[model samples]
Target chain A: MADPFLLAATALVALALGLGLARFLRGPRALDRVVAFDGLTIVSVAAIALAGLVTGRAIYLDVALVYALLSFLGVIVAARYLEGGEQ
Target chain B: MSGVLDILGGLLMVGGAAFLALGGLGLWRMPDTYTRIQAGTKATTLGTLLTLAGIGMIEPGWALKLALIVLFLMFTNPLSSQVMARAAHRAGVPLTPQSRGDALADDEGRAAE
Candidate 1:
């Protein structure tokens, strides 16, 4: 496939995922894992968009765009639960 | 002609990727939750933005897509960081031993008083 874009994007994604795994494994606390998850979301967005570029399909871009918002919202909702949980 | 643009765009995107890697390393290396968040937030934000912009440069059709992604990120990234920080504080995560006053702690203390 003549899609260096996708290849490069995937490499970056893998790197981010690797980092996420590291965070999950060695994280000092729950919040560290959560922070890594946030990073994963961002990487996923970039990866999906790059995939679209590789495939010559504009659809993936939209997915990336939508996912970014959804993941962000998800993080906020999770945060609220976390913050109020002690109460 | 367009080759130079491609090279620049590729460099920008790849450089961003490297920054992302560095940020991730920082996340793993940093000893505390707050510091990890800071590392992840600063580097990943800039890296992702650069990657998105690079894609936009190479693929004109991706302009709107990149723009939309960038827009949502601008709004959400900081807010998410705030949310995570607040959660970390509420969960009673121990701050680094050498920390100064924590505003959230002060506020909560006053609220309880």
Candidate 2:
């Protein structure tokens, strides 16, 4: 239960999540929130992958893959909506 | 051989996490949306890739799927960031005062004509 790698990775990711959340909450613009959200999602993908590694299961990687795809699509949609939602 | 792989995987994962943290910090501290996008996207992309690579190294068997995820991220992260930046620009988001020029603004004007 005391895996150094897992512990280190988790701590670093937690730091990232905290910072990203701070940006998201402190956003001065709508698009700023969007950008922070994107970063936060990517960081989560890494965290999921680390979880997969820790558990010794490959399934979590698949979940990470799907999450990444959804994140990309979501960001694209959000950006388009911000661009006056044309077309 | 096993020991070497374990060490390498741990190193890669740790390094990746460090990059992720840096990306987050940049997102927090960057003055403008454009700069935040640059910092957030580029660093996170590398960080995610490295973390995935480390996972693949440690497990070996999951290499193929991890590679697929890596390839997908390579294409999407930057594309999404570019989309966001373009949208922000079109939405009339202004650059910081210190920013010298807006090349896209010139092109946008031409396009509007």
Candidate 3:
């Protein structure tokens, strides 16, 4: 049986995603958009974790870890690019 | 042992999520981009960390991997938020009139001359 706790967590994360979505739509600048993007990555991780918790699968955790690493590196690269080419 | 930890982790995760929601609220309510950035950065970081920890608790065998995600978020979340704020300033986004300092001027981030 799926744990109710996991389901609840997922619901909360979904709500967070909705908030991020609204922010993205009206962000005042490129950075604000990026911040909203970062928020999306966080939401993705939360969704996966909540699913893993509910499903009792260790595999999803690994997926979440990979997702975190990629998104973090991606944001950094994009941020660096915004800094106007290497110093 | 596991049961107690799981419960604790869930509560923490829930609390953290609530904090994130609060941050989102701040983002919506705060006037100006600068204040919104501060809200997003702080709230999301704490919320994500707690959510990661809850995952670790739930998936005991994969705790190390989940922990790594948490650490990565700790590092990258703040750095990116800071960078975004800096970029905002460089691009000439107007700061709130009463902002205490040139926050985007890299004053805090500036290394000693």
Best by lDDT: 2
lDDT by residue for model 3 over A1-87, one digit each (tens)?
Answer: 225666566667777777877888887666666777777787678678777766778788789878888987787777666655222
Per-residue alpha-carbon lDDT of model 2 for B48-110, expressed as tens digits?
888888877888999999899889988888899999998988888888887888888886674
Candidate 2 lDDT tens digits, A9-55: 89999999999999999988889989999999999999998888878
Q: Rank the candidates by TM-score, best first.
A: 2, 1, 3
Chain B TM-score of candidate number 2? 0.91
Model 1 pairs whose backbones collide: none
- Stretch of 10 with least lDDT, candidate 2 chain B: B104-113
Runs in model 1 lying further than 4 Å from the true structure: A1-9, A85-87, B106-113
Deviating ranges (above 4 Å) for candidate 3: A82-87, B103-113
Write the residue-wise lDDT of candidate 3 on B14-105 in tens digits. Answer: 76667666666666666676677777656777887787776666566777877787887887777877777666555556677776766435
DockQ of 2: 0.66
lDDT of 1 by residue, A4-75 (tens): 644665687678768867886776566677787787787777777667767778888878877887888887
TM-score of chain A of 3: 0.80
* lDDT accuracy of residue B11 in candidate 1: 69
Tens digit per residue, CA lDDT, model 1, B3-111? 7667667767777777777777877788788888888765788888888787777776678868878888888888899889878887777678777867777867743
Candidates ranked by lDDT: 2, 1, 3
Rank order (by DockQ, best first): 2, 1, 3
